[model samples]
Target: MPWIEVPDFQPRRPAQAKAQETRAWYSIKNAASEDEAEILLYDEIGGWLGVTADEFVAELGAITAPKIKVRISSPGGSVFDGIAIANALRSHPAQTTVQIDSLAASIASVIAMAGDRVVAAPNATLMVHDASGMCLGDAAEMQKMAEVLDLISNNIADVYAAKAGGTRDEWRAVMRNETWYLPEDALKAGLVDEVMSAKQAPAEDEPAQMRARFDPAAYGYRGPAEPERPKPGPPPARPEPAAEAPAPALVISVADALTETEVAALRELAQAHLDTAPLDPPATTDLDELADEQPDDWAASLAHLTTPAPWGQALEHLTQTPASSATDA
Candidate 1:
């Protein structure tokens, strides 16, 4: 006998982007497709998200305004650059707000937390992960780089811990273990705040999408699914092609090449020659012989051997000086 009103149930509008600590909101304008090989050439992850580290820091410092906005949608960048950006954010003069209009992942996640405020799109995503670097050098240098990486990881953990309102250990556990999070999940995990911008429906993910880096031909991750319980099978037998006398192509695996008795012997002989034979340095012995044929003085025929390097001064050192006035007593 009474009129009933229906309750409004529409979603609330997303908050307008507040000017962040840096005053200026910067975003990366160019990023290749996910299928392309990412070159950390500019040092800002796939150049996704928004501003590069250089631009971000320089702009952040120049902001006279109270708040700055960092518009991000990156797939992430080099861990080194990410840390540099993060360190900048951590020590910035003003508050920094990192806004993920799309995704901030891997090293980008580190850069995002360099903010006093972190927000994301309604359908955005974030992933936390350990730092990785390609190092090549002497064994000692490689080992030193490894230690440096471990230190970087800890420093990154400290930033995430501070921004997320979480402990360093808690952050490191998730990061070191490669935790990926949906927007809501990231918010729940304290990696970010509320999703700020609205978005269309999240893209349907393919199985191959996660393997963005692996070469499909070289590292086949997907094929016909293997049997749930793999059955024991004989090891793959490499094909033994019929030999031709003086084959046109010498293509062969090193293992197979060495397995040949004649090839092995030849390889050993070559190695022995390289190891045991004394290689003559560029010497004047031959020049001396040629000089003797020039019909000149025997002094001209003298062997032109290089003198040994001077070592007397470098091999030992001794120094003495008068005692100072105070010490002489």
Candidate 2:
């Protein structure tokens, strides 16, 4: 096993570091029945407050259970430490079932591959990327660090290829691209045996309810792709309304003294008045008397007429002088 010692290396964001200050890296609980055991790995892989590779392996060895279930939700840390932990899980005599509770990212994702059967929650996520490390030394030392990182990356890629059915180079390409997988994608890629359906409940449902603690943005990932929305269609066409018939024009014969333009104007005014107000026989008789008595009353009577036929006859009668009166003029 090759190990690189880089003192004073801090490869975590300030917020992430602050959050993990009091949290345990992992927890093991042996079932009361003694046939099954469960381990929760819910923090960074290796840190000052985190479990070391040796400590994790020792605790794993103590479990006498025939079946061991490892539930993981980690952002990953310490490549060498994670590699050791993975190897320990792989070599365990018991049937090891690894379940991704929320996330398994970076080296933690590598550890997930050690299980005999890997299972992921419907909302769980997996991320794989090339191994990274910081080097503070001369040019020659930096070059050596770069080479070591490449070697580590290649080793991690080999583990993925072995589990997921692909060539080492093929997986290396995917890792370089920093591939992210939803539970379904992980199953399709052979990274997980099953994507645990929401309907399926475990013996203890507490772990199933655990929300995703790993933030992809904190680790430089943009998270899963958003679902595509359907485009809107064009609006429906409206029917045109039916046209109405025009009212018949009223014709009035005026005396020869009236000019053609004045007669036409009078015809228009009478037609407008008749269209608005149609007169009965009683109103028409009153209008005849009004025309003889008061000129103002005759003007007002034209506006009260309803029927066009009677109003036009009355208008023609009012405009014409009596034959006897015309001889006197």
Candidate 3:
């Protein structure tokens, strides 16, 4: 009964330092601010598990790779944190390539700009808007906060201007409109260097990741009409063997989408603008200009100056063509 013998005592080896170098870390987290609430929230499932500026720098430094590829699919985060991360990437010795595999909105777009080459998936989206944050305290404090926000916006515009080869004022105007860009639009705007590889056919089986969804109205934004959610169905049966050789596949292009050559031309046009002229700050602030420029009501005032985006024109053309074609017939 007392024959139980214990194995020779062995101490566990101390964790080896830099034993395994990380090539990539999925930056699928939010850019949360450093605060008690944010920290606690990040700790919990409800909060976005974001990589802070310090953490991003540390990871980049720790990795010994000469080239790094960062994959981003974030809904933007803290502006300062994003900026810090961008600077870290920019200063790193390694050649960095950022792949926007999915969405890269708000400050995430700024971070994307830091890459030596930024590539976006055809379906990826990039959004830019004026810097905004909540404020508290008295009127004086509010005024101070507004001024700080304006400065921050200017700083962001400067970053975009440097990367996208546009004047700071032009970028700021785009920001004020809260613009969203597809891959082609991004390429044209110099937001992305190139579009990602071609799309693949739908797959029957693939691992699915949980996607977060929210009301657009909550963010003061509106998006395209949502497609109906598909119900889970039984997998399709295997097709019967064919007697004859399959006919050559017929490819049909969507009328609304851009062609590869067109996208390349847009990229060329964007590259040509690399020698952008610097802009002087206007004599008056943007707010002052807005007042002076828009004496009419909001709808009528913006009409004279607002030029419809190419994508909008494409959509309208696509939508009307079928009806007009039918009428002609």
| Highest-scoring model, lDDT | 2
lDDT of 2 by residue, 146-236 (tens): 8988888899999999998999899989999999999999999999999998988555744543324335577788878899988888877
lDDT of 1 by residue, 1-329 (tens): 10011124323332232223112324322223322211111223423232234555564455454445666777775565567677876786655677776778877887777777777777777887776666667888778777877777787788778766777777778878888888888888787876664544545764355455455757655667866987799999999998878847767565553336545555655575466533654335586664555435334323212322222222222122345433544
Off by more than 4 A, model 1: 1-56, 90-94, 197-329
Model 1 misses residue 70 by how many Å?
1.0
Clashes of 3: 0
Ten residues in a row with the worst lDDT in model 2? Answer: 1-10
Cα distance off (Å), candidate 2, residue 199: 1.7
Which is better, 2 or 3, measured by lDDT? 2
| Higher-ranked by lDDT: 1 or 3 | 3
Indicate the residue-level lDDT of 163 in model 2: 94
Whole-model Cα lDDT of every candidate shown, in order: 0.58, 0.79, 0.64
- After aligning candidate 3 to the native by TM-score, how far in Å is the CA of 279 from where it should be? 99
> For candidate 3, what is the TM-score?
0.47
Candidate order by lDDT, decreasing, is 2, 3, 1
Could you give candidate 3's per-residue lDDT for residues 1-329 as a string of tens digits? 11111124323333342221111223322222111010001110101223235544675566555666667777776677677778878897867778787778778888888988888977888899988777667888788777877788889999889988978889889999999999999999988998966865544432231112334577877777799999989999999987997789978765237666556655654454443422444355677675676445434534533665444543454466777968867
Candidates in order, TM-scores: namely: 0.43, 0.55, 0.47
**Collision count for each candidate, in order:** 15, 6, 0
- The superposed Cα distance between candidate 1 and the true structure at residue 163, in angstroms, equals 2.1
Displacement of residue 209 (Cα, Å) in model 1 is 43
